[model samples]
Target: MRAHGDFSRTADRTPGMTVLTVDLVHHPAHSVLTLHGELDFASSDRVPPLIDAVVKAGRRRLVVDTVGLTFCDSRGLRALIHAERALAALGGGMELVNVHGRLLRLLDITGLTGVLAITTGPGAGQAVRK
Candidate 1:
């Protein structure tokens, strides 16, 4: 199965360019937010609202499926970090799944690997459809 979504820049001013697609999957044990497309400065604006919505929905555990992610920049990483922190503060947790290639390398190089949970394949967390 395949899913698609799009986010664009508004009148708000920002440098750089990015687009984010988020797919929410509901599972028995947890919720999965699958991200696709490029996540950078321009697109980063969408991260905060989405994160807020997830947290407000009272989801205690979340798995972010990054398998479809094509690009991630410092801004994207920062957004992830914010989400991680938010989840922790809410007495929940978040994990990143299916991260590989340059993105994995970037996480390692930036010392973010220690901060976020990275899963390479299935079984990292519960799977659900939404």
Candidate 2:
């Protein structure tokens, strides 16, 4: 557990570079990881450690809030899948919320709409297949 919030630090970046910022928010029932910026190859690797930290802190259920997520490539998708599997292996679960636009379409096109537990729209909670 690295404090109660902002689990990952803001990495130093050069001009015109995009970076991912992951914030940890603990809810009564689960932990929420808020992702911001592009989730491409360079930033995808940042997710796993945070997931591990959350699990290490005794959290099982995790909700990945993509409200601020601007982009997600295949590697980003892989990171998400890995997180879901890692949680499931520990008798836990993970879900995505606020997914829309290209990311949603990618999931749908890749058949991940059925593979990953995701919820869309305002105030989403319950998981639904696309």
After best superposition, candidate 2 residue 17: deviation in angstroms? 4.5
lDDT of 1 by residue, 86-117 (tens): 88888888889888887899999999889898
Model 2 per-residue lDDT at 37: 78
Q: Rate the local accuracy (lDDT) of all candidates.
A: 0.75, 0.79
TM-scores, one per candidate? 0.80, 0.82
Runs of candidate 2 exceeding 4 Å displacement? 1-17, 125-130
Which numbered prediction scores highest in TM-score against the true structure? Answer: 2
In candidate 2, how many Å is residue 20 off? 0.7
lDDT by residue for model 2 (7-111), tens: 223464456655677778666568888787778777778788888887887889888888778888999999999999999999998999989888899999999
